[model samples]
Target: MTVNNIAATFLLGGIALSTQAQADFLRDGKATLGLKNFYFNNDSREGAAKPSKTEEWAQGFMLDYKSGYTDGVFGFGVDALGLLGVTLDGGKGRSVGSTMIPVGSDDRPVSQWGRLGLTGKVKVSRTELRYGTLLPRLPVLVANDGRLLPQTFEGGQVVSRELANVTFNGGRIEHATGRGSTDRTGLAAVGGQRESNQFNFAGADWRVSRDLLAQYYYGHLEDYYSQQFFGLVHTLEFSNDQSLKTDLRYFRTESSGKNSSGAAGYRISGYTKEGDGEIDNRTWSAAFIYSIGSHGVTAGYQSVSDGSNFTQLNQGGLEGKGAGGASLYLYTDRLTQSFTRAGERTAFGQYAYDFTALGVPGLKASMMYLRGDNIKTVSGDRLKEWERDFSLDYVVQSGALKGVGLGWRNGKSHSQAARNQDQNRVFLSYSIALF
Candidate 1:
């Protein structure tokens, strides 16, 4: 059945529940409206591309409503999401490839666009089952939210926390809607042109101790690839505000189904060891962070095996214009680039401070730098690249503007393997609660 039909069915079921059950559901519900104004700009320094620059301004709205589960052995609930985007400005010839704004057949930014989503859920004991629109943050599948509206998936997922210190998750995803587009499309890897309708994943996180946690996840994309991930996080506290955190992650991926058979449409993109599109990679990274009072410092290193670029569920190769944005659970997934090229090694560092310590509440700043070298190329050449990013944020803590947020981000990248560029983004946001 369609998602709308399912939502209507759930609503009808709720209407037939006992009066006390209905009261519990209505009493615990919540609703909110979020507003965001964003501006984006990018300048390409060393590319022959048509649009050497892209600049745009837009406004976004998100209306969210979530109902509580009824009081019963098996309770039911529903969630609805509404998203709308309005274009405030689009620099005529400079807005061609703006991934955050939707374009029309005239190759111009659209005046407005929007979409709606609904999810129906059920709960029993410590386990819950949800179907329809979902924004998952699992190790294997993370929903991207770097643009005006978040990328969403249509699927069913189950989460269980019945066992102490452990949480289990399993899901099957069928479709995805890109952040900048209103239409939904099938799933695919970064470079694959054809669609893979079935993506299955399962994972678990175990709290081994008060200071350490362990995680394992497995994912399979039919006719594409299969991947496994292992992670560990530990924190050592020296005092209340002084501590050290260690994070380690590893991923193993291999070609499967049509990809393994060397099919034409299922091949991945980017540099591969054998110049073939088949996926085979092992990636690992380690990071350490130290914090004392309001200051924080982080250092990390990452290495990608010599087979192919690290594989992930990226739909950038699809036929649509805005179907090209993805996120990775890696420290090197920075603002302008993701250091995941084949045979690449990256080292990165960052420093941050909380301004509240200086008597300026609700303000913070951070800067980060990353250098990557030994990137594989089809011409048998190694390349190097570097990036620096800066961010500043503030929130109103008093008066009529309390809870309003403002942020600015800037980054510069120089690369031997890709274009050299500079980018900036400014955003303002606020949320209003409705009972």
Candidate 2:
């Protein structure tokens, strides 16, 4: 072990101390069970033939249990998550595929695939330490939560919120067993073929004021890649129900470990600078949103350098997962990457509104469009493409049958660089509390 490993171990101990410093006492917890009905369809915009059956159905349950620590200088707690997914319908002929449930032989959707996760934690003043399981969303690394159930990791985390309005988080993840796959694997670059066993990260986010926030993050994966990121977010309020929101993001990354040692990561094989392979990249995005009463509009632009594409904490590729809706978080940039090429730029816009302005208390809708260009592939091909997304949603606001929500989403894409995808989705969810 190196000095860094020793420091990480100490950090983990500190997390345990923050919570365990207090006296012992029983804590309170709550449990909720929700039922969701969903549907997904995708048409192949590219390929020799027309799109076929790409749809599926299932019933799922989520159970959560959390324990609080006793009052004192230190405390301890435990948490557990129980998940169950059952295939209500869908055969080989109609199965679209998904991560929550696996597909069987002949491309048939499975009857079910469920797993449980448990965690142990300790807390001290303004800081907490946890081990066992993790589902994270950070700048350099985060869990994917786009599917029916979120992907999870196994490791330890140290988080501190001691400063007023400023939070610091750091961790060393030793093992990652993907939620979608039954196997556990080491860390690897999105485009690299080699694997690694450790991923180290430290980050901070600060709310400078009521309208402004800033973030700084750094991450290093053993024998893989290293990255640095900075971001600024602000929300400006204007006239009646009108506001302007802005987000500025930037990243600097390069090959590392074995890549730096030669023949690893996305670095060109057998090519080394002073006996070390190297792949450097820089990317940034800026977005602005304006909202007035019932109408909201947004515009954004993102660009990626030609050296190497941006990377994400992907467990299992989304191939098996059926796509039906646009994800709001975690996996934000899906437009351009290594597999799709590089030196890319994307411009996008959205318009949305609330139905309450027209007397419909529980309804809303939005539409978005994105176009990407200047994509450079390894074969020296420049590719261009675009996509449009539309979504509508409503929730019950009153009466005995309140708290139910329904959603519809439609998307279309076209490209000269890769396979085009046309998709649609339907989702219905209800939340019930048993007190």
Candidate 3:
């Protein structure tokens, strides 16, 4: 049967079971509706290639429902998500790229589009098994939510927390729905067209001490690559309400199966080893943050090996395949560019302030700057780049619209090897709960 048919069957079956089960199944249920109005604009600076500008505006609706488990040793539950997007103002020339909305045959944004996702779950003690649509937040993969809607994966996952101070996660994903598309596509790397049906991952998070945490994860994409990740996080607190946080991450990736020999149409884009277009790379980063009351400062450094660009689940190369934008699990993944080129080194710093310290609650601002250099290119040219970003956010502190939020973000980047660009975004959002 088709995926849609399977999803419908799961939805109908869940409803039937919930209706006949104990009252706890429905009594403990919860639902929420979220509304968002978004505006996005990007301008390519002078001397840049491609279109000079792209602009779009849209409204989004998200309905989420989660049901509690039934009364039994092995409990059952269900979750449903409904997403809708409407174009407020956008045309063919302004919506050429699938930034916030998908483009149609006429190269214009569709009037409106939506999708429904459902998952059936079973719980036993502290362990849960879930099947169907999933939005996973793991070190190996992160669901993209930078647009009107969040990306989702199709498959099954198991999460267990039976051990104290430890959590385990494992899953198999077969398909993905882009944040801006209504259709689902098979899993593939950024520049690869051969789809892989088996993307398997397993990971565990361990809390070694009160202020220290460690993580390890392994991922394998059939005929593509295999990857391993290690992470460490620690925080130091002082009596004067001051704290220091440290984060370290590393990844080791190598090609597998068809990609190892550059056969079966499995080829990677960009720079790689001279022999074949195979994947082999190491990337790592370290970040430190200092916080005192409402004021915060951060500094970070990252490096990429000389073998190839950092690899992740990017579908930008799969045009007309229902996938568009993607995100990487790195601190250098920014608004204008990702500093993951081969042999690149990046240094970044940021400062943030919360207005509550100045008697203005629910207001905050932050600014960041990043500089990268020593980038390795196919022609052995050393490239350099930099970006600066600023953001402001405010929320209604009281009255009828107490929870309403407004945000603005602006970024500019200049590079010797990439495009120079400026981007801005504005968002208004609110959420209501129904129990």
Name the candidate that leads on TM-score.
1
Stretches of candidate 1 above 4 Å error? Answer: none
RMSD of each: 1.2, 5.7, 1.8
TM-score of 3: 0.96
Query: How does each model score on TM-score?
Result: 0.98, 0.83, 0.96
Ranking by lDDT: 1, 3, 2
- Put down candidate 3 lDDT per residue, 207-321, tens digits, no spaces: 9999999999999988889999999999999847799999999999888898888884577777785646788899999999999999899999999997878887766666585
lDDT of each: 0.90, 0.66, 0.86
- Model 1 per-residue lDDT tens digits across residues 317-386: 8876467778788888878899999999999999999999889999999999999999986765579999
Pick the winner on TM-score between candidates 1 and 3.
1
Question: Is candidate 2 or 3 superior in TM-score?
Answer: 3
Report model 2's TM-score to 2 decimal places: 0.83
Task: Write the candidate numbers in order of decreasing TM-score.
Answer: 1, 3, 2
Candidate 2 residue runs with Cα over 4 Å from true position: 1-27, 48-53, 93-100, 105-107, 177-179, 182-184, 191-194, 261-279, 317-341
Q: Model 3, clash count?
A: 0
Better of 1 and 2 by TM-score: 1
